[model samples]
Target chain A: MKGRSRGKVVARFGLLAALALILSWLESLVPAFFAAPGMKLGLTNLVVLVALYRMGDRAALGVNLLRILLAALLFGNGYSLAYSLAGGLLSGAAMILLKRCGRFHMTAVSVAGGLMHNVGQILTAMLLLDTWQLAGYLPVLWIGGMAAGLIIGLLGAELTRRLPPELFD
Target chain B: MEAKRKRFGRNDLLLVAGLLLLGVALTLALGVNRRDGREVVVRVDGEIVARLSLSEERELPIEIDGRIANRLQIADGAVRMIEADCPDKLCVRKGAVRYVGDGIVCLPHRVVVEVAGEDELGLDAVAG
Candidate 1:
């Protein structure tokens, strides 16, 4: 039983990682209409949130980090890797904290995560370029992040509701 | 488990509403305080290459290492990237920026074009 459960865990992790990678690739195919360069649908985050709720923080962190690294290697460069690492790590941490608090639902947690991700990216940009001028871009980013976060959160909540609880156990 | 069944509770509604309100407030505040930029500063590899007045209407081709990389145009109290050799052409697609703090950056070419001038709200102070 122990061996079977371990295999199941590995299989689940592999499936989630592949799904997240595909979602990330799909998001890249969609051209960004916004003025900001890094803005996107953040579709892969849906998988991260699902992993966080189902398999706990360790699983979520593993899935999130693996997805960013895989996506970076497959389709991006060093700059994209930096941005994704900063954004994904900060957002994942925020989501985990919010989830633990248990005061709000997945939507709210996801919203906060989305906002923090943008903040992390912007901060990274500021550090790389050595300019405070980038802060001017925050208002637009905030608005965009909020809208994207709300949508992702709603979708994540719905997906979590439909999944079998015993599958993760 | 019962709580998971409810998609959104009062806290969720409050959080969403609060975030929306904050976004709108920030947008309005930033929009109102934005001032027309007096100069367009172009940088290559983080070094200042040129400073052009927004009042002047002209096109300047930027060269990096003896190779033309980007074309910058200043007209009608605004600045824009008209052309770039970069594959993505993100800088060209950014359109025109008239506000004091607006910037157009081409990461591939390491080129940055930003507006610099006096504004009612000091972004530097806020960011600092």
Candidate 2:
């Protein structure tokens, strides 16, 4: 029974990662709001968020890593690849830790994750370019991340609720 | 453990509220008595080279060592790096700035263009 479920998990994980990549592509077409660079809706994060709850933290991390790598390979450059890696790992860690602490619900966990993702990307850019001036975008991006995270978190929670527990739980 | 994760709880609301509060505070801190630049201050190699007004629609090519290193344009109350000679060209991608604390930097040439608001150093409102 365990082996069978493990195989099923692998299959589902592949699909989830694909969904993440597809979301990233679609999100790119949305264009930058407020005419600001580096501000995104973070749609792919929703896939990782759901995987975190459904398949466990390790699986969620795998999903995020796979998506980032694949997306970078498909149509992203070195700089963008670095930015996504930093943000994805940082946010994934935050959400996993928050969930383990058991202090907040899904939405709250997602909110924090969202905020950290932006922080990670900004910090990465600062370090790469060797400039402190980039910090100026922090306040604006943080607000944008929180908004994106809240929406993604709510959607993840809904998906998790409707997902049948017999598959993984 | 799985059961505990379900449903939106009070702590979740509190967490979102806490983050929202932090975001708003950061914005206000950056914003107190500050407004978009009335003019852009261009500096190269730690020295001020020009003070271009945002109201004027003009482009200035910054010359260093008898060569144009970066170009600045101000229009519609915003400034951006229209051209640069750097290999990376990150300065051009830095986009336009309209508010205080916003800036575009060219690391290769050591050029720093920043937006200085109205109240940064008292009034600069006197007409020429």
Winning model by lDDT = 1
Q: Residue by residue across B84-108, what tens digits does model 1's lDDT show?
A: 9866687899889998877888767
Each predicted complex: what DockQ?
A: 0.48, 0.31
Docking class of 1: acceptable
Tens digit of per-residue lDDT, candidate 1, span A15-101: 999999999999888876676767876999999999998889999999999999999999999988998999999999999998898
Model 2 residue B28 CA deviation in Å: 3.2
Models 1 onward score TM values of 0.88, 0.74
Interface RMSD of 1: 2.3
lDDT of 2 at A59: 88
